[model samples]
Target: MTADLGHGVPEPATTAATGGRPEGHLGAAGPAPQVVLNLARPWGEADPLDLAGAALGAGLDGVTLADSPRLFPDCLLETGRILANTGARLAGPCVLSLGLRHPATVAGALGTLAAHHPGRLLAVVGRGESSVRNEGLAVPSLRTHRESLDRLRELLDDRAPELRLLGAASGPRTIRATAARLGGVLVDVGADPAVLGKAVRLVRAERPEAEIWVFLRAVLTRTAAEADAAGRPVLGSCASRLVRAPDWYDLPAELLPRVEAVAAAHDYRRHGTPAARGGAGRSPETERLVRDRFLLTGDERRIAGQLAAVRGLGVDGVVLAGALTGVVERLNKLATAVRAGLAIDPAVRTGPAADPAAGPAVRHRPDRRGRNLSAESEE
Candidate 1:
């Protein structure tokens, strides 16, 4: 049963919330999509143990820490604390930039962690966006980036087969390249069912064996009022992340001007913050449109609908990232609100909240040079 989603994309209606693999794809029908938390900042700088407990209580499958070495505490150290404290089967650096550490050293560290915990370690690699840029270094070209991950994959496999390797891609070329080189892809494409479906198809087309995950800035609240109260950061995320992939999903014709303004004003340097202003017009209309497209806010019903829409697209999982404030609170809220609503069942016993690619995720962003970068990217 196929349903048209108005954007020339079709979704498999029967698959909604079933966690079933999409048909006609080459990848193994793995477990249902997982819900993992990739910490942008320590849930208001909360203790890692408390955060791990929050994840467990929320029925989360995994947890990942953002790996900006200088801006925050060591992600691996935080990961160790989470692993030691919680029963979570997935945890690690959401993205460890290749520029900061040699793949061999990283592989060694994660491999060691996997040896102690086993099947619980996962690694994501990117061009080292904020971290590298902070040091006044240039990000790696796609070729060098992929080659480095390829080596990381080789070393990881030799040390711990259970460990999974993923990449953060900024466009379709990177998505395709990531699908070919790594275990999975972390995408920031739009959360529309059609867009999710398209991303799934694109990754499987390149490497049916690969897994996929969506990176979203979400906070599922108990009330609309609560959501709106703390939604500024989420709205900010829309401007920053979505603006990067402006073409990933179609904006209403009425909102194009505001979106363009957002693109023009997007702050590439502070791209990860909830306060990042990617240039969206200040009008309530623009904020609403951007909010509805990129964020998961409001009450439980709204959160469920969005997660269902994402899983409906046959995605294997979602990575929830948000502001430093109330992150733990939101994760706990997701356990109750999202778990109850979506019936999220993470099959991962050890690794893979699992993914690492997409249709021009996929908002196929236009770089400074105006070349379309296709991805649900980070950075």
Candidate 2:
């Protein structure tokens, strides 16, 4: 699939490549970055399918399920259930740790999901954390990650899943491998513009046509204090990754110790939870610094500005890690921010903006069997 590099903004090629028409494809539709909801289960109290339905209803681009079986439900099973029920395209089970499942097993499960939801599923694999850490397994090296991805790709060759397999990469080596071998690279770092831009440039340099997706922690608050409060818990997840590899991010020297503190105190059992107070030791001043630097936060207007800045960096899409509480409400706010951000460019925000309370129009495509797979009926 060709990367949409027009206007210096990256756009998803899946719709064009798969012969499906999503709301905003390349060309006149404008480069509206695909907004994928990260439905990492067990974090939220609501049912996963219900969240998927609500997100799709809100007109978000797609949904990604976490692949941590011990902490969350089975990703493949939940994905099939979501596809069977909603029109939203699926992008996970992301970060499938090579240490837990063999390449063949992972490929078989992915093949089955794609076969059932052809043209609407994307597989993202990586050397995962939390999932493997909790089980006492070592996270695979970059070499293992690349080799596993290669083996999985070869395994699905004849089966014809007809889907793109993306690699979740952050470091230089893994990013280059993803560009050369996989369908694309999903940047695993939190939403830091500098880091994201560097990652995008590296992948684009290696393969100009490769798709780039970024994962960001999302929080909406009226004040900086509220932003810090809402963002502290989510930062735990980021700190966990950063602590393991300090050189991975371009962090300020003053904040390095805080990050290390969070990493040293991290508990796998509380991974991705609001209760995960890895940042407890951080000074209030330091916590605020981390929040301002790493998270996508602020009121609607501020968030709009931040997202517009992200779009300027040229990412194909952004996957938001949902807030711990009021998941649906936060998603609606995010959708609003995205719409508001697009409005920054009059040419990009076309048509009436979607109402946060009402369901947005979701387009559907036929599976191999020629059956319509949309949430709404066709005329």
Reference-based TM-score of each model: 0.72, 0.80
Q: Of the candidates shown, which would achieve the greatest lDDT relative to the real structure?
A: 2
Expressed as tens digits, the lDDT of each residue in 231-260 for candidate 2 is 644566667556555566766566678766
lDDT to native, each model: 0.60, 0.63
Error of 2 at 227 (Å): 2.4
lDDT of 1 at 179: 72
**Tens digit of lDDT per residue, candidate 1, span 114-168?**
7876556656778766677657688787777867877887787788765656787
**Candidate 1, lDDT over the whole model:** 0.60
The Cα error of candidate 1 at residue 296, in Å, is 1.5
Global fold similarity of model 1 (TM-score): 0.72
Error of 1 at 121 (Å): 0.8
Clash counts per candidate, in order, are 24, 0
Q: Which stretches in model 1 have alpha-carbon errors above 4 Å?
A: 1-31, 42-44, 134-137, 221-245, 251-257, 263-275, 278-284, 322-327, 344-379
